[model samples]
Target: MTETLARLNATYTEHVIEDFQKKRVPVEIPLCLKEDRIAYGHNLEISYPLKEVLDVSYRYEPGKIGFLYIHTIQGVRTFQINSDPAGFVEQFHQLDHL
Candidate 1:
């Protein structure tokens, strides 16, 4: 069973789903990093297997913190949230042990 390691409320700012096209949309969803996958969604759900996550990184700007995730199948996606970015890195590092 994959347990939820950390959960954060994030906004999908990179892209969105529109009428028959994948476009960029701004929406808030629950993001979770579990034992075996990273999942995020509200009414819909998307999950990326940990094995396919090639790399994880973070960036700090003047007023915003971002998390960058590179996955094999999902490509590269960035998420900006209001939580501590350092904590996010630490959480993922812990997940690496699992």
Candidate 2:
């Protein structure tokens, strides 16, 4: 997760999100099959920090509706309140267990 956050921070640090927030509307988590960690929807929100990192931890895998978490950057943050449930295989086909 630290590596992932660093990659995001490098490309989308504080300044980037500040510009984005100003130009666009805020929305819930953007569903994406974007990375090995996220392809299964097991990973969650991307943090965009402006100056400081508050904390980082895995609250859950984020495969349920109303599941929410905070991503921070300095003084700014975006809440991703997801409202989607995992599909049968769509959610677990990749699992090494089961």
Candidate 3:
């Protein structure tokens, strides 16, 4: 098994009852970065291997949430992240160099 380099949670929207009304709420999902792949989802059902990762980037807003983009061979995947993605991006870059 490969060691996990970093773990971050991505936010997704889910329909739920709030104040007796159905509303869209943010849900947290697990995203794990291994030496070879990035696994994400409630049960880590989806993953993109490092070899398939074309690029990674983060977009931050002044007062809004941040976004992380993973460009893979398959397609571009975006994740809504609440915290700074600088650390995660840095780690990915470091591992990519190895």
Kindly report which residue pairs in candidate 3 clash with one another. none
lDDT per residue as tens, model 1, 2-57 = 78777777766667677889988777787777887778888427887878876666
Residue 6 in candidate 3, Cα distance off native in Å: 1.2
Score residue 45 of candidate 3 by CA lDDT.
82
Question: Whole-model Cα lDDT per candidate?
Answer: 0.69, 0.30, 0.86
- Model 3: number of backbone collisions: 0
Candidate 1 regions off by >4 Å?
13-25, 65-67, 71-74
Candidate 3 has an lDDT of 0.86
lDDT of 2 by residue, 42-96 (tens): 2445423322333322222446423322333434333333333233213323333
Q: Name the candidate that leads on TM-score.
A: 3
Which of the numbered candidates is closest to the native, going by highest lDDT? 3
Q: Model 3, range 1-98, lDDT digits (tens) per residue?
A: 77888888789899999789999988999888888999998888888989999888999775688899998888999999887777778889887532
What TM-score fits each model?
A: 0.66, 0.24, 0.83
* Consecutive 10-residue window with the lowest summed lDDT within model 3: 89-98
